[model samples]
Target: MKERVLDLVFLIGVLFKGLDGLLELVGGAVLLFVTPGQVQRAAERVTARELAEDPHDLVANLVVHGAAHLHGRSVWFVAAYLLLHGLVKLAIVVALLVGTRRIYPWAMAALGAFLAFQLYELIVRPSVAVAVLTVLDAVIIWLTWREWRRGRELRTTWRQTVAWVFRRPQPREA
Candidate 1:
């Protein structure tokens, strides 16, 4: 029974990693074909806006509208975006494969689920993805605490070494 459960968990992790890879491909294509012109046009619009007293409004307006205008540029932006996007996806695939080899099974499972939750709206059901993110966030936080503790221990050791080296030696004579 335990073996079967472990197998199931491992299978789920592999499946989620595959799913994330697929989504990254699709997202990269979309971003490449759509982002440059939109980004350029948005930049132009921000420049066109009447000068405002508060910089916040200008910043907010650009953030809210720039991405909505993805059709503003030619194919060059698409080409560059897709190229960079592909490189990023390749790096992620390498990480996933490396992680599977080096990390514990449960940690691998958590990593896969975390990626799925983060990309939920893109790959899985949006509502379900949001729920997964909420639940997985607690797990991620706990994992982060372990990492933080390890870092603290290292820092303490480093501090001790520095203190020993830097402290003035006691005076031998009055």
Candidate 2:
């Protein structure tokens, strides 16, 4: 039952990671073609709707602020950021799903680094999205570490069993 639950968690992480990557990729591509004015206009519409529903919605306020900041900004930097992030995430998800033992440690390290960055960003910006992502990354890191340890133990046990079975018998001729 415990193993099943762990498997489920890992599966959910994989799915979420893949979806996140896809969204980033698509968003980046869209940003390449869409003008900042268009983005701001869309954000304004969404923000207005959200604020109408909740007069004091923090996210809506953030959206308005972000849109205002985007008005004259160069979006290439953001586009590049999104594309790079998306590609890395997709690669990690694929590696994990393929059960690459050597990749496990690297994956954990990459995720840990990203998590640390996100935590730092949260400290500076304090967004709900970043906080949720940090939590998800923490869960994935734990699950990946657990799976890596289990794989190592299994390999060690198999080696020991094989060695014992194939051991040469001492000379018994009397």
Candidate 3:
């Protein structure tokens, strides 16, 4: 059914979000533990072969350039951001998968705040990766909203069914 398909897509999105969060956690740890100079050196070492293969490789050059500019303050900021964001996202994912009514609004609110921040970032400083993330978050928000609405409808139906089942017989009619 269409509803099942939508639910499946939502589940997939949540899993993807969790995976991204896990990657962010690992990246944060790496950034936290490694010195800027060491990271720059590692980037150079890792990209040397690729650069050699393709002298004008965009990705290799970007990595080299980005690593070269990594500063201590920026590294700390990014590490903290990643670790916190990852932890929050993983927690939200767990809440979403558990099928609870009360948690959805909180999760949606958290995601909405993230989306707002992302949009502001996009306006101030745009990047392909950030744009992709923004889009994904938007889609997830819409899907989550749909799920919340569906849950409300299901709850209403369940309550009505229970009420009807428990309704008293009319003595006057009898």
Tell me how many clashing residue pairs each candidate has.
Answer: 4, 0, 0
Please, what are the lDDT tens digits per residue for candidate 1 over residues 46-163?
6555425455564545554544545545344544554554454445445534543333334435545545645754455444434664555444434333433434332333345456
- Across 9-30, the per-residue lDDT of candidate 3 in tens digits comes to 6767878888988999998899
TM-score of 2: 0.75
- Estimate the overall C-alpha local distance difference test score of candidate 3: 0.81
Estimate the TM-score of every prediction. Answer: 0.31, 0.75, 0.76
* lDDT, candidate 2, 74-156, per-residue tens: 58877876887888888887776664588888888988988998999899989887898899999999987887887843234
Model 3 compared with the native: what TM-score? 0.76
lDDT of candidate 2 vs native?
0.77
Error of 1 at 74 (Å): 18
Which candidate should be chosen as best, given TM-score against the real structure?
Answer: 3
Model 3: weakest 10-residue lDDT segment is 152-161
Candidate number achieving the greatest lDDT relative to the actual structure: 3
Error of 1 at 98 (Å): 8.7
Error of 1 at 139 (Å): 7.7
Which residue pairs of candidate 1 clash?
32-78, 37-73, 38-69, 38-70
